[model samples]
Target chain A: MTSGDRGIRGVDSAADDFVARRRGQASAPAAADRPGWRPTRALSRAFVVIAVASALGVLLGRVDLVILALPFIIGTAVALRSRPTALPTVTLQLGTDVGAEGGDVHARMRVANPGEVPLSTAVLRAGVSPWVRLRQGHGTYAASVGAEMGNSIVVAGRAMRWGAHFFGPVLADTYACDNLFHYETLPAEAKRVRTYPVGEPFSADEAMPRASGLGGTHRSRRPGEGGELAGVRPYQPGDRLRRIDWRVSMRARELYVNHTLSDRDAEVVLLLDVGVDAGTSGGVDGKASVLDTAVRATAAIAEHYLHRGDRVSCLEFGPRVRRLRPGTGRRHYLSTLEWLLGVRVADGVSSDTRLLRSGALPPNALVVMLTPLLDDSSLSALAGLARAGRFLVAVDTLPEHVRPEHDGVWSAHAERLWRLDRENAIGELREHGVPVVRWGGAGSLDQVLRDVTRMSASGKAMI
Target chain B: MNDSRLAQRYHQGRAWLRRTQPGAMAVRTSVYVTGFLAVVTAAAPAIGAARAAGFALVLPILPTVRPMKVWPTALIVTCVAVWALTGEHSYALAFLLGALLYTHHTSAAQAVTMRTDTYVTPEVVTGWARRTGLVLLAAAAASALVGLLPRLFGRTDAIAYGLAGLAAVVGLGGVLAWLVFRKL
Candidate 1:
């Protein structure tokens, strides 16, 4: 369920569909009829110069003026000899529609001359998203197309970030008759390339607080017919004969059976705080912002639990309050990654916390809230979820190097006081029995989950 | 308000120049320099007023600004007029000025068709160069024929020469009309 694994399966199909759709559209008659040859300003300028010089030479009887006009006449007549009747066809073909962050994407722009006349020259200009950088300088190119021939410009670049990025709205024009007549095509639509965030390796050895599903990998506390042995007791009426411990029965000279814990699944709810985001994002290879850390961490945790046969869901705690229903399997894991692509910070907006008490969240489910903890609303939401008896773990997603911008003399002192206040708020959250832990990739939640599981078993309530 | 509009236009022009590709910029620079040199050479022997006018007209061809569409043509015509008025019919100088004028015209056309950031391919450059060279050869041969015709007929038959010039103008006018009226 890693981003790379998902991309390998999804990339080819997505790219094929996009290319097929574009080709189908380009083959239509309307597309062909849209572009036609028109004379450029250069042609008019040349004609004007020739006409003016010829008029002057004839009126004044100056042979030198006529000599000056001779080149213009020859050049213009030679250029106008072979006029292109039809325009060239332009299409953009993408390497893949889906890719992982830092993965390379290849694109080819094809300009095909459909006319009997050869194109003297053709120019192509394309616009690209800042997230994708093409290897070939700027996206402008010029080339000559022979009669009934085509030219392809290959553009290769890396996907710098995680999102749906566009390759181009490519603008192409062809010149013919010695660059006299020009035909320009309407800009082609940009191709979308989805880059998924790469998740870090994560695993947790601790048991879930409660297991609900009938069949899974986790061991439950209730005694049942399963792998992990609970104890040996006198045989009951409904117990199977295979469960009998022969050694214990023979030594005691009585019928005895082995008791085992049931294997059941648990639900994991990932709650993301998008009220505020801090730090500058230098793309995948550089420093990550708060949102970046939360997204990557969430993907890792979801993958870990989903791979273990546990149901996982995601919720955005912002003005929008976006939610994904709980589901299990490889398909759900892919859907989660797709959903994380739209994560954005909405400042000056209050979060709607009514979802906590709306029964949308399962009481026994482990709720992991990813937040920067820079805003009061997120802290209050975490406190409310804990107060409602939901198993909650608040993962601090703020980058370590992030600091407040200084503008005044007291800015440094103000930032220090702010840091102290944030520390105190974290301490207060811990006292309220909501474990606030800084997100450290693998084994991050093991200690916290272990303690939560102990508290759940004893039926302890938060203070 | 006019000042603000001018400032806006100036900024826009600067931005366009900034985005111009290095190769395209070089070609444009060459056009400017060649055009300036041609005007100065043609006007060198003329009066101060004509030289001043020629120099002033050439200013619009500077690479620092977006070239005025008519300025190159205007500058060439002014310089040629100045040369004619000087009453010196030096064939070598006329051919030299003609070559420079042709170069400026073709380069200006190439430069305008391209965007500010266009990466001009070597094929396109070579193709233009080849075509220009061929046309220059044709123009040189035609010029030699024109120069020879006057010497052979002698300058004494002024009426016949004027009549022939008038007929040539009429024929060329017909051709120009046909080109303009034809489907483009």
Candidate 2:
């Protein structure tokens, strides 16, 4: 029994119902509602009034024109007819702002059916404004509503620049005007949409500071930890084989040992630019705003750092600002996800530079920013943080492929201006001694990271 | 509330609409019209023209223009066809119209059918066959009722009497639709 076919609500529950029905215990009605005498809506039936009026006018005047109007008359008459079908629930939410294409990364939405009767059908869609690219899944579903299976669907879209967007009122309808405009449809509850800001990505381009708060990285610099072995005493049972120097033992010493130090964790702070213009084209898979990229990047970096037992923090800004302080471990990761998931771009229109002041960043923290570097708001913010003597890396998610949007003669000129602005932004970042990596659409990634870091502070711009 | 009950209601609704399905109405119209012509023929040979013309209004509406299963759209076309052919009052022609209408909505083979994707999902095809089987079983009982009704009552015009048969068929059928929809 398919859950949505009055089958069952959840996939698990549908399985149970199928088993029960096969065992002669389950009983659901086999009959579906007939397509007649169904409830309809005033909006769809409004055309019926015109048809009736046409009929009345022809009857009163004895006009023979009604025959010519047969198609319209019949079409409107059909539209007026009522029909039955079930409705499902819908919901939408936006993720936090940090940096990337422009604003928030992706908009996530879900539709669920929470009703007794199986809705033979339901559809949900988002009215995404132009900008961000979808950073996630296909946002469509077709299914029935039943108990064993939840007739539910989810959608994620992008918005480049974030301000605010509203979504709601699930379009639960049974009666349709050729499946476009609907008249009768019982809604199955659930209708909500939320917004989020942009988050930043971690870039290897940023220069790491000379020191780290994490002791292990600093300890690797000490001579005693990573030096060649002098010699070793007679074998101690607890001694590691990695420390054994066999050649020294053959020369004169009984057992010599090699020395080694443990690996160190790097502290990373993703300074994301959630400005209005982040990337050239739509950011997050198309729907993702820079804010969304930043959030995801923050989560990814935080996850990466936490895995390495390193301290990681996030700073997000767009119209406004917020901070998720440096921390490590699973609890911190979850908290970070929650924080990133909840934010959207600020509405201030001006970047909040207060967060980037020298004293604001942790002492010698590794600062990696994700931005398209479209405006000073995001660029100045990162430059301020980098100037604080932190290991600064800027991950550029700007337009990698220069595509044309219009066929007008001026379009080429517009494209050049866009390229020029980007060049200026890159140059400005280089002046601050910040290591910046601009992502090419499909280039070798590790090589790019390696190349970007190989350039000394003086040889920053070869592009 | 039950599958059978729900089926009964749908049956009733469809039966009522079959006042508009081709087969039910066509069969009823055929019997009655044929008998009416017979009665008129017995009374006087000249009565045919008036009688046939008089039935024009009811012709399109009766036996559902084509057949009850053919539905609301068939009414006008069936009416026009019946009216045009009423000069002859041919049973064969009426039955043809009824077949055309019914086949328009349903057919024996999957290829000769309407509604392709939506109704023929894997799950729905299975359900449709199961439900169709039950309906055919229920229809057997309706046919039996029609066959035996004459034995219980005095002889009347077989054509006119077919109305009573059709009514019984639809009335029982309606209850069947309801029962099926509601469950037994």
Candidate 3:
């Protein structure tokens, strides 16, 4: 299991139980009513030895032997002189509520002693999750605790994967004076942080084919507030005075206003296929699998279009349909990433017509689908999106290094047949006028976008 | 220049060891070996009585030196050894047992206070030493009191000494009962 999954079973399980119990309790459980301080087996053993050894020395007439029992005498004196103390209250806190994958999370636990007696030996053990890689700081700390003294212990570790990772409920075992008694506390509640997948910086200079929204960097054919001159026309009352061309008016003997192409934004819809991942799993540092490529490429594409002031939306069809409605802004981009973190393959494919509660996608919107074409469900979903009369492009996210896992004559034959079927699928997509291209890191979509723009302008736009 | 080179080499060797060996295993191994040597030294008073008792007492504590339980048993056994080998015999066994108690308590506490992946910091070592020193100082004061008790009541009658021993036992018993029953 990966470290992310390992934590779900170990410390997280205890945290779940603790949370359940806390929910079960109608009110706060009284601390004093709980198991009070009692003598340890070690303390009892010391008392037995001191009594038996001292008696034996008296009976045996061993005078010097009495001197040898001094340490036990002192230990007994110390343990008895000490008073029983109430258990301390501990709280755990993380440094931040959000972090990126491969970034560190800092944690601090505070232990407060609210008793009259001081603890000379205090050992605090904070439960750690396996998701924390390269763990630093001592989870186990030993120090003295006075009645008014509270301590803050710190620990830090790197998050190995992107997801909701949990850390906390420090278990504290402490001893009263002379280590005579030990008190243990249960595991605390787990704190979760959403680790977003750090997207690779994407740069695509290609101008979009269709611009739909009111204001953006892309120049639309319609005239509005922009620097690009479309033509000169007779001035209207509502037209801005700054747009008036004095030289043109002087020549034509009438007031003329400068007309420019409106700078408008486009609606970019990204359809992600999470149905099945083919080939070996070599993590981020190694060769990415089909799904890994799809997720990363989706992130890169979303970032690119969003940076250009385009309304971006995502629809994922695997075993379940997950969709984020069209929105624009920095917060919306973060919401899209947070939604993508929940993307995983379900048992079987299912579809819902309410992919957008806002109704069908705009006809002028540019639809980009990311899929490996390994499963027919995603292909069918893509076709449904295209049939809705939206312009579409399918980016093939299949890694270049994919090969059959088995080594045999029949296996080789089957692998060849699979590749042939995939090629046929791609050929069919092309027949429907959906351009398919491999996703390269930068400028991968430039040529296809340019071709689509040319085709759309020539009035032969394909749905 | 030669001294600096030697120091650099020493640092390199230490780093290599730190990378190769795990902290927990090194600590456990060092503790067990040192504990075994201390038990053998404490047992060196004689083979039959002191050695057998020392071996029996120290063997179980070698793996997990539960400082609280192990120290009391060790003190009792050391007292037996001291009484067995009183005059014209070595008193080194008693001193070694005291030192062993200190080392055993400190090492066990350190092993508990740190995780397997982490090493003992210099601050923790200093803390452990200071705590152990305070305990040893108390033990030393009590030993001095024991020595003074004999001198103050020297040449007393058997009846008076017996009565005194009985009173000490009764006083300890009453105090223990009161602490356990009422105060607790």
- Tell me the native contact fraction for each prediction: 0.48, 0.00, 0.17
Task: Write candidate 3's Cα lDDT for A427-455 as tens digits.
Answer: 88777667788888788888878777776
Write down the worst ten-residue block by lDDT for model 2 chain B.
B109-118
Ranking by DockQ: 1, 3, 2
Model 2, residue A263: C-alpha shift (Å): 9.1
- Backbone clashes in model 1, listed as residue pairs: none
lDDT tens readout by residue for model 2, A53-110: 2343233321111221222233333432332233344455445433333444444344
> lDDT (CA) for every model shown?
0.76, 0.42, 0.63
- Give the least accurate 10-residue stretch of model 2 chain A, judged by summed lDDT: A1-10
CAPRI grade of model 3: incorrect
- List ranges where model 1 is wrong by over 4 Å: A1-35, B1-22, B47-88
How many residue pairs clash in all the candidates, one count each? 0, 113, 1
Model 1 per-residue lDDT tens digits across residues B1-184 = 7998999999999977666677666657756776776676677767554765577455635522444366666666666677667764656567677777777777776765565577777777788788888998988888888888989989887778777877876786677556645775
Against the true structure, whose TM-score is highest?
1
The CAPRI quality class of candidate 1 comes to: acceptable
lDDT of 3: 0.63
Q: Report, for candidate 1, the interface RMSD.
A: 2.3
DockQ, candidate 2, vs. native dimer: 0.03
Candidate 1, A1-463: lDDT as tens digits: 0011111123334444444443353322233455577776667767776777667776777777777777877788777766778768788899888998899989888899988888877877666656776666577787888899998888899987787777766767678877777777755667888888886788999989888776778888777757889999998899999999999999999999998998888999999988887887767887778888888899999999999999999988887778888988899999998898877776556553676645568888999999999889988888887787888899999888788878899999998999999999999999888898898999999999988888888774742
Better of 1 and 2 by DockQ: 1
Between candidates 1 and 2, which one is better according to TM-score? 1
DockQ of 1: 0.43
